[model samples]
Target: MKLEHRIGQLLLIGLPGPQLDLMTRSMLQTIQPGGILLNTHNIEDAQQLVELTATIRSLIEVPPIIAVDQEGGRVDRLKEIYSPMPSADLFRASGDAAVAARMGEIASEALRTLGFNVNFAPVLDIASDDGANNGLKGRYLGSNLAEVVRLAGAYLEGLQHGGVVGVGKHFPGLGDCALHRVVQQDQCSLECGDRRARALPGLRRSLAAPLVAVQEHSHGIIA
Candidate 1:
């Protein structure tokens, strides 16, 4: 591989505008970027995204990976345009693996229709009642390891079947930090040994699905 290709592999860029289309095409042709991460800002409509992705991919022999944070509920970028998604905790509360699976599939379909190849989903972070919580509240499945495992598994399964590569995130347990505020957890030094144990079960389950990768959060270390 060329040095240009090697450098491109390290970038996970956000899609800018039409003016940059030529530049974007040139970069992909010359460097072959590793992936493209999308957000609500990039989403205008399903058709637009499809065209944009097609244009970008045309520049390379192999299509570049396209990623998005379409975790569902409040985190869903297409919530306003598509069906409303349930929170991860809701799936856990229902204890219905089928429901979780459906959610993932639905999310995957929505993303794929918009030309995305990857989804940052199935948050495996366990939530705690403590003030130092890191679960991201409604975004979390539940505090119970068993519930988290089941729900995340189902969600990933759906995404996989829909041809979307799922990514489980915020490793080492985000179960004990406050939301909104930037609270970091040192997973390597948590006093509560149970936190690691609780989070692992979900991580293991998430990985068991057809996932592409797992994101190590910026928070801190993982033992």
Candidate 2:
């Protein structure tokens, strides 16, 4: 591959709409990106999603990674096809790792059937404050570090067991961040240092899904 195409393979981008139309096809052919992360905008219903993903594959020789943020709560992209999934807190509230695993299994089954290979899931951030508007309120899986690790591990295990890759998200623990508010880059280490210990076990549990990120996108991650 050329250097330009090699660089293009590093990107994982979002589409503006559901279908892979002429413009989308052109973009995919040109970029040949490493992956495409599908959001609600890129998914309408099951049948449309299948056709769209199939078209994406047909556009390129090597299949591009297809991903979705189907972590339940506010981020369930497949909610239109599958029933609305409960937020992560509900599983924590249940205090049973099995419940979380079951949910992950069911989710992976659906995502795999819909032509997705990656499920950005099992938010590992600790739920510290309910009042804080960091965009991770309902998305957090545990009230503390241990709960996060155990339940998140169970969930990811289920996701992988069904053959869909599970990407444990927001590494170094993005528990409290605000949207569009850029902080000093130098301070990132200081901020993330405390959470690194907590994040490792979850990483070990879901090692199958390689963790990766880009620019700050949503307030759901930033405080």
- Candidate topping TM-score: 2
State the TM-score for model 1.
Answer: 0.82
Best candidate, lDDT: 2
lDDT of 2 by residue, 151-179 (tens): 87788778888987777666565565443
lDDT of each: 0.72, 0.74
Give candidates' CA RMSD values in order. Answer: 3.6, 4.0
Rate residue 199 of model 2 by lDDT. Answer: 57
Instruction: Name every residue pair that clashes in candidate 1.
Output: 132-176, 132-177, 133-176, 133-177, 134-177
Give per-residue CA lDDT, model 1, range 6-34, as digits (tens). Answer: 78878777767632466666766887788
The runs of at least 3 residues in candidate 1 whose Cα sits more than 4 Å from the true structure, single-residue gaps closed, are 130-135, 179-202, 205-212, 218-223
